[model samples]
Target: MRICIVAQTFAPQEEGGAEIVARMCARELARHHEVFVLSLGMSGDRLAPTGEATGEDGTRVVRVNWHNSYLPGHKKPLVGRIEKARWHLKASVGAVSAKEIREIFAREQVDLVYAHNSARMQPALFEASRQLNIPLCVHLHDYALLCPKSSMFSAGGNCDTPCLKCRVLTSRLKSDGEGMTAIAVSEALKQTYLRAGVLTKADWHVLRNENLREDKLHRPFVGRDSARSDIFTFGYLGALSEEKGIEDLIRAFVDMPNRRSAKLIIAGRGREDYVRHLQSIADGAPVTFMGFTPPEEVYGVADAVILPSRWREPQSLILIEAAAYGVPIIATNLGGTPEIVEDMKTGWCYDPSVAGSLAGVMEKALKIGHGNWWAERDKLFPGIRGFKGTAEASRYYERLNALLVEAQRPDHLHLQAL
Candidate 1:
């Protein structure tokens, strides 16, 4: 089968979590089938540039600019609900954009269309797939279809219930997404969309994302000495955003009495102001902000990986990396985290809501050396097949091919949830 992956961005141009998954997916699937990519370029808000190029992964990628108020990139995201809702409302409708996709589908003779995050390439995307009479598979990476902010988090807190603005903005999106096949990274994400009355006629399956660390096999196990409790190092290695709980992580690290014996290493870059704000709060504390550091280098010296995300991560790559590298995880008990992290057994979990909850866990990890919690790595992550990540990769394609065959039947639609 020939496949065309439709995403907002692709690798070699962008290296976010979603792009990495799309790039790896194209390569992995190419081993069995021909693969092509339809992605957006790094242009400004203008909807120009229609050309084809080869991605760094050596996959053929067709890059096109978006037809939106502004393309989402390194810049600050749209602020204010009213302004954000307006952008989504306008970006969703583009008859010309739909025509462009249909033309690409016909030219490529694409057998199936798999969509990752269609930030400004929606409604038209669904229409194109329907017109081509091909299977449409939507990968649920975030809450973009349910909420305009994508994270379902705004105004310094979480949105448990949809506000009036969200209802108005997502009504058309929910209608457009009703009957397409979907592959959610976590069961929590599937249920979230289901609870919102979206994707009712569509088929749903969960496939956890595989580890994307380049040094997955190269990095030595972090905590080999479980009993040695010397000067500790805690690492936070993702975007430095507010919803990511970067501020909260710094506060907990600073307030803890055990902080004197430990240091915090923050890697990854964000908006300049936000990164500066985080650095300001972490002033005088034993914190080092290594901007844009790779995952392997961060995990190299760190004793434990910290994922203090306040927003519910559908499936955090950081959490998955900690497990794969034989490093103990210290994360919040939210979203897909608990599914992998067992309290006091695998690693430590903290409540992000309650005051002092995160600090308490910080002290716990400090008291008990990192290697102590994970004495036997194999017993802890028994599902791990090897350092090369064969388990999750094989399961992804295995389930995908089986689902494609199953979708051929008339009455029943089924797929296994890994």
Candidate 2:
């Protein structure tokens, strides 16, 4: 099948986990089927190039430039917010030409359009697919359909209900339309959308994000060794945003006993103000900020990793990656995290809401000792197979395409008409 993987951003310009997952899925799909990526380009120029280029993985990528008067990449406080809002508004109304997409679909003879992180590209492509009689499947990586912020996290907790602004933004979001299928990275995320009345009319499936390739998993496990090293190292790798609980992680680390002997390494980038605030709180503590360390380097050195997310993290790829590296995890007991990290068996889970809860968990983790950590690793490493590779994930996409094709059959339509 000739598949067009649509996303807001692709690799070399990735902002988060969604892009990584999309690239991996696209490359795996390309092994068997022809794959094309439609994404936005990151440039402030008015007439930046908007055309096709071969991705690093050999897949063809078509980058579309957002040519709105409202600067798409502007970062000024009030003006930037307004520009982003205008861009999203324009995108929702199909400002990006449907004719252009139709022409591309025809030229490529695209069999299916698999959308991942289409917040920037908007629902225009979805409508175009419907008009062209092309089957479209959307993979939900975040809550962009229900919340403009996309994390469904605000102030300090998961959003239980949409606010007035959220309702307005959600109203502007285009519907999935008839015959569209929705794939959620986790069952928790699926239920969240279902309860919010988002994607209610579409078929739903849960496909966990792939964490590591089989070849990458061949490295020797790095279990904690308390005897070899006097200081225990705890690491946090990902975006340094507030919703990610980086502040909380720092606070918990500072409060841990014998923190002088233990070290906290934070490796990611976010708002400088937040980073400064974290630094202020971490003063006098053994904390090191590596800015942005690659995942391989992070897992290689850290004794354990912490995912102190305050929101309902829909299948954290870091948790699986850390586990795959034989490094234990200490994560919040929210959303799909528990599904990945079994408390006490694989890693520890703490309540993100309760004060000192994460610190308590961290203390427990520090006491696990090298011997116990290895024992847990021995048990959990075998189960890591399910989350390791993209081969199975690609097969899921293939199955989805077959199901969609069958649903579009003339006889199937006739049966449904009865």
Which portions of model 2 show Cα errors greater than 4 Å? 42-48, 69-88, 91-94, 216-230, 343-345, 375-418
What digit string (tens of lDDT, one per residue) describes model 2 on residues 1-418? 7889997666656357787778877876777778899876535532224687786668788876654553222132345767767866665454566667778888999888888888555656766787888877788888888777787888777887677777776675657445777778887888888888777877677766753455555355433222233467788998888888999989888888867767888899877888899999999999999997777667777777899988888888887677656677888988888876773245778887788998887777667654565555556444443333333433555554455454445343311210
Best by TM-score: 1
How far off is residue 316 in model 1, in Å?
0.9
State the lDDT of candidate 1 residue by residue for 1-418, as single tens digits: 8788877765554466776777777777787778888876545323324578775668888866566655554443658978865666776444137788888889999888888887457677777888878777788888888787788888887777667877777665664344457888888888888888788668788877763534344545532334233567888899888888989999999999978889999998888888888888988999999998877676676777789898888878776666556566788887777766762244668888899998888887677655554465446544332433333543656666565545433443565555
In candidate 1, which residue ranges exceed 4 Å CA deviation?
Answer: 42-48, 74-86, 176-179, 211-216, 219-230, 343-345, 370-394, 404-413
Q: How high is each candidate's TM-score?
A: 0.87, 0.86
Tell me model 1's lDDT, rounded to 2 decimals: 0.71
